[model samples]
Target chain A: MMTTVKQAEKFAAKTLTEDGLIDFFSGIGLIAIGYFWLIDNSALSAIMPLAIVNFWKISRKRISEPRIGKVTLARGKKGNVRAGRTILIIVSLTLAVGVILWLKGGAGDVQGTWYYPLFAAGPSLFIATITFFSAIYLKCPRFFGYAGWIIAAAGITIWLGEGPARALMISGVPFLVVGLWTFAKFLSAHPKADQ
Target chain B: MALKPEALDKVIHEPARLLIMTHLYVVTDADFVYLKRATGMTAGNLSTHLTKLEGAGFVKITKSFQGKKPKTTCKLTAKGRKAFEEYRKNILEVLKT
Candidate 1:
């Protein structure tokens, strides 16, 4: 009986990890970073969240439905609100810190010093932190691995002076590839239900 | 603190139905296919269990069509959730003793 309960719990946790939605969103966010850097266009990058949402919805309709079927999570409404607040807090903190540092020494004074590295590292660290929290909340260990990669990539980009935008793009590649792989695997695992 | 077996909910006592209820407790609603995959049960078995749950007013099943395809979703009713909670409490109490 205990074993059965454990298995049920395991299954519940696995549901969070099974869909690959996180990977897909992460991939899109990273690619947006890359595009932002390559084109130096903030406008293009600004659309990333929307793009991720649309892509996820479309993919769920096309790819996920045929395979794993639809699952409307019970806590989805509350989860969305929490996720939004978290992102807002992270973005606000990043901006506030950047503004403070810039005011202290001006852009020129801060550009070649520790401030530059901190600025470059801030967003990635935020992503890593969020992923870590998600890993804990979802009971999915794989997210920790993703967080590690984001942290490592952030550190490397700081050392290389690649800027946060470029670093995000660079770090995002693995997530994008992994997301695609996971999507493909999911497609194969469950075929479309017969009409 | 001996467990009165009668305290346990007979409807939720079955392992398969217990698993199904547990899944519903966590999520707002889940489709038939999702439940089947999660519980590793055949369509017929799952359907049968769902019928029992629905009959007991423990779960609400909704049927609709998405495009040309049919969709069936299940959710735990308020009574069902309360009962599950009570069931868990009783089980825990029994285990503690």
Candidate 2:
């Protein structure tokens, strides 16, 4: 047997926990968005379903049906907070900052210099937090962690700096691409256990 | 005892796989990607070990499409469950000597 195979199997075995499932589902959401753009043609529309997928994936995995049913990731003592907390935190901060910026600037136009940057902050912080948490959750850094950090950086850049929409578009594309690629790789490598 | 036994033993004896099986033995399904990351293995590596386990009839590998991508799940089989239990006892019995 290939030693790498043994290593991969060992890794898979450890990830068989509830927190692991959530991470995997978050990955699913990221990958689904890639395809969603193809089907819906609107990245905005894709976000909703992507959110929905995150919700659905967790719920689906959490409800365990006995015998040929879904299994739960192990939870001992306090369970690791999945992306849910991270998502909530990012959304909250984005809104808080958006509100603060809006109040400071006074709303002449909602989409002006203020809100676009605010919007960028949400995803930027989200990707960053996820990158941090999941990397920590895995007990080390992964290639995905690096990619996610880059996405987070682009998002932060879009938030802090003033630029043409084209700049946002340019940076956003690579961030999204790298995020999707990591998710796709994760999905392709997932093992199927025949019951 | 069996050619596959050594492979199964490798999985079973490993602290991580044993821990994984301890969880999976109760659950019906688990995502392989999650498993691999948790176990700290590479993509090609995990698949190979899975193939070995599946070949031994110690575990079941089910491949399905979750949207366009393949979602591979793993579950312990009746045979696998039985074999591991026996294997565990055998190990314990030997240790007692």
Candidate 3:
């Protein structure tokens, strides 16, 4: 029936809806950025995976999987190709820029002048790009909003010297709040599987 | 474009099964619960349709246990995908004629 297409589209949209996982991960990452200001930057990197794994375990056990059941979408070939292209572009650009800077002997000066801002912007840009691509690939428009938030946060950090901590929190808090809210709604929307 | 009644797939022509197939077409695999929620179909109704689809080789049903809970996941077979495409073409041809 013609209605089948509508129903299928609705199902696709539901699958893409935010359930708070993004918020949880990005929230912890932001909090880690705050810690980065006080401790070694490497510490934050180490904490990220552990934090994410723990959050995933908790969410699966307590929230999402128990309610809606675990749905693992197959990453189609197109998705893989897009991801591969994005990675290749980023790696190529980084290498080309590094080589140019090295040849010009401008690397040291640029790092000295713009280290903090560049450092902050790098991750922010990476997150924004991923979010943008995900929005397009998943047909989830909300990710575009998150991408905007990351860009804005990065812009603010660049404007304010010694603003990495604040920038991280600025971008991170919204994701955390939205994620938690979405999780709560998800819980209410889907009753316990046993029920 | 002349309409050919035989070109239509009777297996997929049924409404409930059509819905099930459409949902399966988008994702790689989905559990019974997820399909039930998406289709707004009763468990008995969905199970019956799934059995039919499975019998026709249009769907592959996998049964496994997660922490003692039985998990039933359904996937559209390559045959099913090709059949659905053909069905769509047949329907469009009918409409155009």
Candidate 4:
């Protein structure tokens, strides 16, 4: 934690409006897909936006910085944990497409089987979990911070059938709100540290 | 290509401005107080650099009230972002030399 102060001070923090919104859009994009996953897969609503937001944020960082700091540049890579992420996305999309095909293929009920959701939900949820844990360790109010974890946990609960799907949706509302506040706090607390 | 040659060099030349641009580039935008803190400069000193930037039209400043408190926001102009990119390039080039 003491070392985190130097770490924190070494970098500049973005304002609630700027830094926060980037994460907010990203958070919303992920949640939107997760919600679509819960409701109907045909919506095709979440994937494009998620892809767009993620790519945009990535390009913004890489393009905006000319000779990026070694620290920040490295962190932006989102892990060359490339295989795990690619597999997660590909499998999740495949499940989504399969489920939609099933529903439209004359199976009216979209109720998912336990085994199937493990394939669809598990990987996505796991990624969120990684994000959640990292945010906690970083001592920042990143979108994947506690609020994200709480919503994500609820989503996991829903996937496991321990909680209602609505619980996941309801859990997310607070993340949308308080995540902004926490981001502001992060910025305010470190106002002079960048200098 | 993302940065104009002139703007990039301008921001690159000064160590403080280089620091300032790097900080701003990271967070997207910053305020006077945050800049002061990050740069370790006094308010007046921060203000002077800010004024120079504001005059050059690299950064845009907005003054408003956040309830009873006055809030000032400083955002990089497209011009300013170009300058930051330029600054980065110049530094890299210099280091290479």
Candidate 5:
């Protein structure tokens, strides 16, 4: 009985990814970043992740929930999520402070130049970290696969001296392909439920 | 000790309703579509079980509109939660005996 209950809860949690919208949006975000980077638009690339977060939320309400329904898991299950968010906040603030200090320490106006190495390897590593915790928090192992692919892409790009754009585009392809296929399959399997 | 067969809450003893309560027990709330899928009940079957649970005051069902479409959400009421806990304890004791 206990095991069955746990299984039911797990099934509910699994709904987060079953529709494949997150992967789909994540792919679009990364590809957008790649395109934005290629065109020398750092600001737009930077905002892609945030934009995709909103898109994912909206898409879930519009697309996924209508089909599979909405199940908001218990708050007690979000301990890991709280920890993840705390760590993210700390890391982001630390990086912000470090950048400020770097500028103050006579590294003036080095937005794109002094940070070249960071740029080349940072997005992949950062996203890898985020997706890693996201996997744990969301109870979705596929995110671990995403994290691994991102890190591998980062390593390859850094070793080959390839730009971030190419690595991002490469990393985004699998998610896009998988997400599209999964979403299509999900739609077919779970049509809009009767109200 | 004699087994207290009467200790089990009859309202939740039904397998389908048991599954529904367990699912709602773990979550704050869930929609009709979600519950239907989680319980693998046919639309009419799930609706029947949910109505029974709702009538027993063990579950609260709210019908509202999400846009033009109808949406039904269910949550375990306080009475429902306590009854579920009580039911679990009784079942555990029975198993122990």
Candidate 6:
């Protein structure tokens, strides 16, 4: 009985994020955001995750549900997933606002200070925190891996004197690679269901 | 007084159907393919069990079309949910004994 309960819970969690399409799109979005930030285009970087999230919803319906099938989880479960997403959006927007303010000279300058490196590392760390929570709440192990990778990449980039742009770009690679591979395997495993 | 052993829900007693019921109980509803994958049940076996479940009025299977492809989704009925909960209670009681 307990085993069955656990299996059902696992299924619910898997339904939250199974195909990896979100991660795939997330990776591309991160890379784009990194590029935009590198060019000092804060607006584009700010909007990228939101755009990717919208695209992921459409893509899941078009690409994933048709292949693997669909499951509408319980209301509480759905809410939990939504909450995780909302937290991510909040973090991204907060980072964007901070960056924009710093650019506008609203925050006092300290470009040469140790805090500058911390500033560059901030977004990635925030992303890592969000992903870590997602991993635990969504019960998706891949997000945990993503959280670790993002943190490591952020640290490396900062240590090497690179900015958050580099951190974001490097952080995106795993998601893209794994998402594509999972999508391919999913397509193969579940062909388009015949009428 | 000892509880009757047969008081346990026979419909959900079978392993496969129990698996299906447990899955449905956890969600609002699920499609045929998702259930198949989750349970690791063969098409024929799943179909047969679903038929039995439908006959028992424990599961409601809906057939529709998503674009050109046929879609079959299953939802546990109110009666089914009650039955499943009762079954769980019974099993827990038995285990306690």
lDDT of each candidate versus the true structure: 0.77, 0.52, 0.72, 0.52, 0.84, 0.83
Interface RMSD of 5: 2.1
**Tens-place lDDT digits, model 4, residues A1-195:** 011223433454332223344455545655665576567673664464757567656643333221121122113335545654675576567656755765664654444653444433443454455555445334355545544565466566656655233343444555566646645664564332221
C-alpha lDDT (0 to 100) for residue B14 of candidate 6: 95
TM-score (chain A only) for the predictions, listed in order? 0.78, 0.43, 0.73, 0.46, 0.79, 0.80
**Fnat by candidate, in order:** 0.52, 0.12, 0.43, 0.05, 0.76, 0.67
Give the poorly placed runs of model 3, Cα more than 4 Å off.
A1-10, A41-47, A50-54, A76-84, A95-117, A163-166
Scored against the true structure, residue A87 in model 4 reaches a CA lDDT of: 54
- Candidate 2 TM-score over all chains jointly: 0.40
Q: Which pairs of residues collide in candidate 1?
A: A74-B28
C-alpha positional error of residue A119 in candidate 1 after TM-score superposition, expressed in Å:
1.4
**Model 5 TM-score, 2 decimals:** 0.83
Which ranges in model 6 have alpha carbons more than 4 Å from their true place? A1-3, A15-18, A75-110, A113-118, B42-48, B51-57
Per-residue lDDT tens digits for candidate 5, residues A160-194, read 87876878887888789889999999999988776
Top candidate, metric lDDT: 5
How does model 1 score by TM-score? 0.85
DockQ-better candidate, 1 vs 4: 1
lDDT of 3 by residue, B1-97 (tens): 4666879989999989888888888778888877877777888999999999999999999998877888898898999988888987787777783
Point out where model 4 deviates above 4 Å: A1-195, B1-12
Q: Residue A169 CA error for candidate 5 (Å)?
A: 3.6
Top TM-score prediction, candidate number: 1
User: Distance (Å) between predicted and true CA of A123, model 4?
Assistant: 9.6
Per-candidate RMSD, Å: 3.5, 11.1, 3.6, 10.5, 3.3, 4.0
**Model 3: share of native contacts present?**
0.43
Clashing pairs in 3: none
Candidate 6's residue-wise lDDT over A124-176, tens digit each?
97888788887876678989999999999998988887888899999999999
